[model samples]
Target: MIDAEITFRKLEIFLCYMQEETISRAANQLGISSVSVHRALHSLEEGMRCPLFTHKGRNLVPLPQAHRLAEHATEVLSKMHQGIDETRQIAGIGQGRVRIGTLYSLTLDTVPKLLMGLKLRRSELEVDLTMGSNSDLLHQLEHQKLHAILISVTDSDVDQHQYEVLPLFEDDIFLAAPKLSTLSDRHSVDLRSLKNEHFVSLNEGFATYHGFQEAFKIAGFAPKIVTRVNDIFSMVNLVQAGVGYTLLPGRLIHAYRDSIRILSLSSDYQMRQTIALVYAHNQQLDPNLLALVAEGRMYARRRSEKR
Candidate 1:
């Protein structure tokens, strides 16, 4: 076992002295006094419990043990540096990968556009995506399982003190039904008129679920619910099969244009979702997150311009 007194710093100074072949020159290379260099070498020799040098008049001559120690010390320091770099990469620091979470519905447009833009800006960066409900994503982000999340902030109680939020865009919720439904001909849907309709809804904790509840509250009656699904795609599938009516965000319209009919909500029950990128405030300066924030800003600008 090595003595605790023999430190990485001492090893570094020893290596420099071995290369420079003189105390004054090693000190010059390391920006320290010659006495400090000599003292470090002496302390290192004492820690090793072996003679590393022989004094030849004013010069210190390296023994064979010193040469062997230098070789091993170089390998140890190199490995240490490699380990630190790998750890930092895995932590999403300094040009490392970023893990992003989003709602299943965003996969159709918002997520694709943002990720594509991110790729263009950071070609070497690795992006991992996990899709879930708004609440699940927020929970994962809070637990440090995700580097950032793209989600609806309007429905979530996002603590401003804990997170940095960058608003992406507002999505209007529309009444969605089977393609051939009679409601397709209507310009706008009033929730009160649909009180007798059986609806399929997303489960609680989803962003859209809050909107669903709010719209019904304004209508003053709860519509019969056929079922509650966990994901938007499943809800859309049920709607397409004519199981029941559902609400959808405008961003998902293009993906099911032929399978479902989307109509604007009447002013009395109109609901809009504000989507944003959310991450821990402490990680605001991380390089991977910085890239994500820049990409989010660009995406928001493009969405605004298109509107």
Candidate 2:
């Protein structure tokens, strides 16, 4: 029977040392100290009850037995990883396909760029996209209906203990109106000044809607609501058709620059949205989610560089 002291971690260190041919190099690869590597190898040999290495002029060289153990160790580690992947799949934790949820507003650029990056990183990954309001997305994520979600963290109650969050970017909210509207020439709009104006808004669950509520609450009075929509694109259309003014994040500015007017909110009513990628804390180790997180970080870096 194998010794109980023999461990997968010891095998990993042994294999690294075998390939690198030096304790220091192996330690560097494993992110451990050289002493730790030496101790682990010595312990491994003791567990095996054989001489796996021979000292030669300040260097420890692998013997023939070590070479044979290396082959078996490599196979063992490979099989162990395969078993983990298979188990995760059977448990429905690490499926080949990833279900991603996002806010409707993000589909304009942020979501597309990240998805493209993810596809490039994982060619065999099957992706399913769902778009909804912030509250809706978070609800789906909490219930495990979505593998991950991209949504605004600001004003949305995300429990940090339950989710792993990666912030992508910060976007300022702006007052949106028709291009030829009377308010178009203004550098910025005060929510207090529009207390009597008719406005279109997203329904209660959206992050933008939360901002809308806060901005108006700060203004101390509610504006007349002309209509309520579920998505930002529809609200943008209503604003362009001169239906009513609405608040939107800065991300959509360039897309509607020609048709809609986007003005900065006054200091008193200014709101910023923090968009992030969020997944279950337990799913952080899932390979597909790992790729998604990496892509999100890359996207965030590129976005910051452009600023």
RMSD for each model, in Å, please? 7.5, 4.4
lDDT of 2: 0.90
lDDT of 1 by residue, 141-213 (tens): 9888899998999534799889999999999999998876887465788888888888999999899999999
lDDT of each: 0.89, 0.90
lDDT of candidate 2 over 128-175, digit per residue (tens):
999998888999998888999999895337888889999999999999
TM for every model, in the order presented, reads 0.71, 0.78
- Find the 10 residues in a row with the least total lDDT in model 2: 179-188
Alpha carbon deviation, residue 147, candidate 1 (Å): 0.3
**Superposed model 1: Cα runs more than 4 Å off:** 1-90
Colliding pairs, model 2: none
**Alpha carbon lDDT at 148, candidate 2:** 95
